[model samples]
Target: MSANCSWRSSCGRAVWRSSRSSSCSSRRPGAARPGRTDLASVPNGQAPVLPRTTRLFQGRVHAASITHIKPPSVRAAVPRRPAPEPEPSGAEPPLVATDRLRKTYRSGDLETEALRGVDLAIRQGERVAIMGPSGCGKTTLLNCLSGLEDPTSGTVRIQGTDLYALGDRERTRFRARMMGFVFQSFNLLPVLTAAENVELPLLVTGVRSRSAREQALEALRLVGLSERAEHTPAELSGGEQQRVAIARSLVHDPPIVWADEPTGNLDSENSQDIMALIERLNAETQKTFVIVTHDPDIAGRCHRTIRMASGQVVPEPVTPRAKGRARAAEAKR
Candidate 1:
C-alpha cells in the first residue's frame, strides 16, 4: 500500500491503495472521501471522482466552506430633545421688597427689637417716605434695607437680589452700585472741596479721575452748587452744604436714593427747598426715593407715606397727594 493514498472510507477511515491507480479498491460502495461529505453514492463499476473545488495541501485534499458575518452598525439613530420656552416679560418685578424683616440689637443682655417683621414693597420710580417718632425703628428699617446693617432674620430683596445673601464686602460693593445715601449731618469730608466731596463715591467705585470730576461737576450743577464747587464745607452755608451732600448722593446716579433725616438740621424754609429739590430729582430721573423723616411737611411731598410705631408699621390714611396739597395751602396762609 502507498502512503500517498487520497481515499477515505464511508466511516471516515483511510483506505490504502496503490498511488499509480488513482482509485482505491478497498473503498466501499457508500464510502465518502476525506473532507468531501456532500458526494453522492456511485454504481459498483463507476469510480467516484473528487470535486475540482478541493485543494491539495501536503499531498492531502482539503475542502473549505467560508461563511461571512457582518458586524452591527456603529451609528445609531437618536431622538432629539426640545428646547425650553422663555418666560414672558410683561410682568415687572418690584424695585424693592422686604419679607418679614426683623432686626434685634443686643448689648450685654440688653435686647432691643428695632424691626418686628416688616414686609414692604416699593415700586420703581416711586417716592416713599417713612415717618414715626424717635426710636420707632424707622432708621433701623432704612439701615437694614440699604444693606448698611444686617437684619436678624428675614429677606431683603433689592431689584430682585437677596441683599444679605452676599458677603459683607460684596454687599458693600453692590450697595455702592445700586444705592445713594444722604444723612442729616451732610456726611461730607470737611477737608475736601464741594466737587471733591461729590466725587468721592465715583472714586470709591473705581471710576476714572477725569470722568469722576466731570460727573461730580454735573451733579453739583444739578443741585445748583456749580459756583460753590471749589468751596470747602466751612466756607459754605448750612443750606449750601446740604446741597453739596445731595450732589454727592446723586453723583453716581444710583437707582435708589436713601435719605435719613435729610431736613432734620435745616430750618422750615431750607427744609422746603431741599424737599423740592428731591421731588424734582425724583421726577426728572425716575429714581426710587426712600426717606426717613420726622417732619410731616417733608413726608407730605412723597408719593406715599409709611408710618411706624413700636417696631411695626401703623395703619395710615392714603392721602399723600391730599397732604401735599394741604401743606401747600397752609404755606400760603
Candidate 2:
C-alpha cells in the first residue's frame, strides 16, 4: 500500500509508473488508475506489458487484433451440405433407359460380347416383352437394364439414377428398393416357406417383421398362392414355385419388374396360367414389366415386342393382324 509502488520486472523494463500519492488498494471513486492495461487500448501503436503476476490480455498485439478477454459468444459453425444429384433433363425420364449399352465378359482375354450398343427405353407402366433366339443377349440385356450387371461401354439409367456410377453397395440398395427380378430357375431357398420367400425382399429392406409378413401375404394372395404360404419350395409344384417367385418379386412393390424366362421351367398350362397372372397384375398395379422370353405366345400378350439378335434390337415384324388392327384404330380415330 505504498504511495510509490513499482513492479520489480526482469530485464529492467518498466511498462507503467503511476506517480500518485494515493495507494492502489484505497482509491477514491474518480481516482486515477493505471494506463493501457485493458485489452481495448493500444497506445504508441504497441501493446504494453504489465506485472508478472498480472494477466496479459490481447488488444493490438504486434499487428493482428486479438479479442481474448471475455469475448462475446459466437455460434458454432455448421457443416456445408452435400451437392444434390443432377436431375435428368426431361419432362418425364423413362422408368428404365439405356443408351449405347454394351456388355462384354473376359476370362483372361477370352472375350465374349453379350451386348452391342443396345439402345432401349421403357416407359413407366408399360408391359414390354423382349424376345430373342437363345444366346442372343436377352439375359445379358435384362441384367444390364435391371442394374444386376454393369455394361462395359454404355449407360443405364433407372428412374433417373446412373446405375453404374453408384458404388456396389449403393447400387445393390437401389435395386433392392426400386427393382424386382424373377428368374427362370425359380431361385427360392429350399428351407424357407412360400411366405418366407415372398417376405425376403421386404425383410432385406428393413421393413418390420409384422408389416413384411402382411405385405408378403397380400402379394401371395395377388399371385394366387395365399393358401400355400406355409408350403416349402419342395412342397410346391413347378408352377406354384414360380408363382411364389412372382409373389416375391412383387412383394417389395417396386416400380419396375424384370422376368428372365420366368416360365421357362413350367409346363404349357402353367406357363399360360403364369402369364395370365402377370397380365392381370400388370393391369392392376400399373407397374412396368420387362419380360425376356422366347415363347411367341408369351411375347404376343404384351403391348409390344422387342426382338433382339446379335446383341442388337432387330425391327419387329408386323403381322397382318397388326395392320388390320392399326387400320381399325385409324378408322376409329
- Indicate the residue-level lDDT of 87 in model 1: 70
**Per-residue lDDT of 1-333 in model 2, one digit per residue for the tens?**
122334433345333433334455566676545422433343433444432222333532122232332212234558999999888676466788889998999999699988989998888877889998899999999988887777899999988898999999999999988989899999999999999999988887799999999999999999998899999999999999999999999988899999999989999999999999989999899898999998999988787788999989998889976576457645844
How well is each residue in 149-256 modelled by candidate 1, as lDDT tens digits?
A: 889999999999999999989898899889998899988899999999999989987999999999999999998999999999999988889999988888988999
Estimate candidate 1's alpha-carbon lDDT, on a 0 to 1 scale. Answer: 0.82
Candidate 2 local Cα displacement, residue 44, angstroms: 82
| TM-score, every prediction | 0.69, 0.69
- The models' CA-based lDDT, in order, is 0.82, 0.81
Worst 10 residues of 1 by lDDT: 66-75
> Deviation in angstroms for 2 in model 1?
88
